[model samples]
Target: MSPEFATRYNRWRYNLYAPVYDRVVAAFFAPRRRRAIELLAPAPDERLLLLGAGTGLDLDYLSGCRQLTAIDVSDGMLARLRRRADRLGLAVDVRVMDGQRLDFPDACFDAVILHLILAVIPDPVACLREVERVLKPGGRAVVFDKFLPDGGHAGWARVAANWLTRLIATDINRQLGVIVGHTTLHIEHEESAGMGGFFRIALLRK
Candidate 1:
């Protein structure tokens, strides 16, 4: 699929999944999400950006940072996020924005949070480039996502499944190292976050 088509499809899919997103993903990813946030350790008053902040599940872990901006392509997701933020009294600036084309100025954010987004987005390289552009010098990005291990091969089953999975949710064969290599961001720390080391937490520096 083309980039435009993939973006539109992702938006439509996420909108349809928004209502049950928490029930479906939150519990399973809760541990990794917490670990990612812990690694971020945002200071008070620091400006932060959350890419693909679906349903604002990470909001509770980010309460310390007062300046929070979250962007997602799904209107339904952002709407749910807004309600959650309000109920929790968190001052988050939520916007319907594409990750590959960030609307913020260069060097604007002190930190960035990217969880469960790389595999789901169509253009991971472009998204990471945008992240590199918006993050301030010495800023860190906390990323948590499933990626194929270095030098490991995807089985025939996974390769075939990706054909269907990409139509709805995530691609299981994304290479984290290859994607990160496309930008200037360097990994400062890395750790296995979920089962079988498929999901990982990587602290990247700009």
Candidate 2:
């Protein structure tokens, strides 16, 4: 698919899913999200960005940080995020923006939070490059998503299933290491989360 088509597809798909997204994903991914925030440990007054911040599920975990910015392509999703943030009495700057092309200055943020976005976006490398660009030197990013383990092979079943999954939400076979390696971010720590190591949290530094 063309880049524009892919971006539109994701935006449309997520917009369709926005109403039920938190209900669908929060129950399953809550633990991993909490762990990721714990690892991130955003300090007060630090500027933090959340890429593809669907439904603002991570906002509560970020209570300590006063400055929070979240971006997503789907206006539906971002709208829900705004409501959630307001209900929680948290001040968040939520925007309808593309992850692959961040409209931010270099080294502008102290940290970035990426949750379940890499596999969903059309260009993971470009997204990571933007993450690196917006992050200040010594700043960290907490990433939580599903990826094929490094050096591991995808079985025939997974390869076949990915075709359908990619049509709706995510690519099941993306290799996290390869995507991260293409950018300037350094992997500071990594650990497996969720079932059978299917999900992982990686702390990356710029």
Candidate 3:
């Protein structure tokens, strides 16, 4: 499929998945999400962007933040996120925007959070380039997602599994290093998050 078609399909898929998303994903990803935010270590007043923010699962962890903006292509997901922020009594600037093409000014944010986005977003290279463009010099971004191990080849079995994975939710064969390499972002730290290192959390600097 074309990138545009893939993006549209993702938007539709996530919107359809929005209602039960929290119940299905919240518990399993909570710890990794928390760890990713902790790695970011944002200041209270810093401007932070949560790219591909879905259902605001990360809002609870960011209650102390003053300037928080979240963008997602799925309005259904952002609607739930807004409600979540309201319950947390935090003011968040939430917009329905594409991750590959962020509608933000250059060097405007102190930190960017990419939780489970790389594997799901179409054209991960474009998404990372946008992240690099929006980050200030020396700014950091924390990425938490499933990636094929660095330097490990994706065998036929893994490649075949990715076909189904991509159709329903996310692509399992995406490589973090290869994606980040498309931009100037540098990986500062990386650690295994879960599923025998299938999921990873990494800190990237721009």
Candidate 4:
């Protein structure tokens, strides 16, 4: 909600990075993404909300889901999502909306997934509020991302890596648990791992 947050995010993400988005993010984290998504273990009938879905790479991971709503800040990214969805005969309700200001009714989704999206936003806490608002009572969201590693992290080395990567991709150093603390969701489970010890997946309840 800060001044120009949506404009800045969309302009950079779409105009500056759309052409290379897939290659860069994929080259860096495809294998890791696959592993994380598999761990999510979504059921077929679940009403899924995918935040910052970016081009629907996660679509391939949703084998059994019946309904899916894909949201991204970039219209270009949503375009890619639509084309891919059309090619695959999958129908995802694509919305060109910021995660922090999702325009949906309460209790709209059975589950939500924020995959490497929080850190890219100006205020990840705002995005979490939107997630908590739309999710049904007792529903939960699963997240997969790389944050500044804490215990097993390489300390200064990891910090350097974060800054360097930010020039290209979003940094992997956000404490999503802390951001979601104000919401009713309880952090049910947390896991961490990666090539550089920089991945975290948290399951949360509303």
Task: Find the candidate with the highest TM-score and give its number.
Answer: 3
Clashes per model (N, Cα, C within 3 A): 0, 0, 0, 2
lDDT of 4: 0.77
**Could you give candidate 4's per-residue lDDT for residues 62-149 as a string of tens digits?**
8678799998878878888888788888878998887888989999898987888876766778889889999999888888887654
- Model 3 TM-score (2 dp): 0.99
Instruction: Report lDDT (CA) for all predictions.
Output: 0.92, 0.92, 0.94, 0.77
- Which tens-of-lDDT digit does each residue in 1-206 have in candidate 3? 99999989989999999999999999999999899899999999999999999999999899889999999999999999999999999999999999999989999999999999999998999999999999999999999999999788999999999899889989999889999988999999999999999999999999
| TM-scores, one per candidate | 0.98, 0.98, 0.99, 0.85
2 versus 3: better TM-score goes to: 3
Between candidates 2 and 4, the lDDT winner: 2
Instruction: State the displacement of the C-alpha of residue 18, model 3, in Å, after optimal TM-score superposition.
Output: 0.4
Candidate with maximal lDDT: 3
Off by over 4 Å in 3: none
**lDDT per residue as tens, model 1, 1-206:** 88889999999999999999999988888877887888889998999999999999999787777999999999999999999899889999999999999999999999999999998999999999999999999999998998999678999998999898777778889988899999999999999986789888999999
Q: Which stretches of candidate 4 lie over 4 Å from their true place?
A: 1-3, 149-167
- Superposition error at 66 for model 1 (Å): 0.5
